[model samples]
Target: MNIKKTSVLLTIILISINAFCQQEVSLSSKLKSDKIKAVNRSISLFGDKEDAVEMNAEDESGIGIIEDVEFEKGLIEIELLGENNPGKSFIGIAFNIQNDETYEAIYFRPFNFVAKEQIRKEHMVQYIYHPEFTWRKLRKEKTGEFENEIKMPPNPDDWFKAIIHVEETTVKVFVNDLSEPVLIVDRLTKPLSKKIGIWTGFGSSGRFRNLILKE
Candidate 1:
């Protein structure tokens, strides 16, 4: 082969390898038998014959906890899409998950981020330590401490990227902006090291993709 042709072929090969390395492994392939148990109705996975998981429970919340992946102190990034109707969607991630009913979660109220009412805007993002510091209790006791308004809200119906950084006792959430964090918690309610999973609330449906965890 000519020298120029060989050089071009080598560059193309390197680019192809890099792209394959960055391609996210579908969460659907990591689900375990007991990891994801539908509460009220069955959850659905859709993406080229089902490559992504969607929360579709009607009466109660649905979840798909990834098995064997224990996230301690690192970064978690994912793309999420929620319903656009006001007060209709709750989509987020749960970390330090001890079990099905216990975990620390940070989710977005997409419908509330740009609502007409001020109160709704105040509830754009939420943090909860399940079975204890639920959003209601935290709001009542600590008021404006657990939840914060998203400074730059993204469209509810469109897909948005969420980047979560978890350190020993602190957890910071950044949405679409790497330089500035949208929410920061000095102390996390749950332990620092635990399993991680996707979360949805009652009457909410969401889709997730490109879930990557760095430990």
Candidate 2:
């Protein structure tokens, strides 16, 4: 082949490879402004794209649901970073989300993981059914059923991976470690398949990237 022809072929191949690697949906494009307060910012996790959805909510109820995606039974893997501070920072995913007001969520209170008090550690991971079954209600009614402490905790300030597996009535959450789930809920509040979203609690700011939904 001629030198020019060879160079052209190489460029084409590189472009194709780059396009394939960046095919994963970006969070910024999936979420709407009214659903959750967010802004586009550069994320190191996604090499092909420079923008990731940064959830900036003054209230804990802010949620960014992915548009046009129906999540029934599958796995959701994403990278999340909670605000690093002494106060509680709720950062996680909500699946089976019917709307902003309704969904089941698995969130992490990073500050609690390394708290001086043992009670705080117990509330490290939480599973809540919005508008009905909250962490407080569940803890009071069903102890040790909805929330639990992480066996292996990650840094609050650093980015960590959260893997969520949902099938019918069962939902399991794995943080950092894929082998064992940190928290499991056998009886899901909303059993049917619904939209998925990235959630942030009141007074919380989070960064999300590489949102992949597999069914």
The 0-to-1 C-alpha lDDT of every candidate, in the order given, reads 0.77, 0.73
Cα lDDT over the full model 2: 0.73
Query: What are the runs in model 2 whose C-alpha is more than 4 Å off?
Result: 1-23, 31-51
**Native-to-model Cα distance after best TM-score fit, residue 36 in candidate 1, in Å:** 4.4
Model 2 worst lDDT run, 10 consecutive residues: 37-46
- Candidate 2 C-alpha lDDT tens digits along 129-176: 987888779989998888888877888888888888887888888987
Task: List TM-scores for all candidates, in order.
Answer: 0.81, 0.77
Clashes of 2: 3
lDDT of 1: 0.77
* Tens-digit lDDT string for candidate 1 (134-196): 888998998888778877799888888999887878889899865788888765564745677
Q: Point out the worst 10-residue segment of candidate 1 by lDDT.
A: 32-41
RMSD of each: 5.9, 8.4
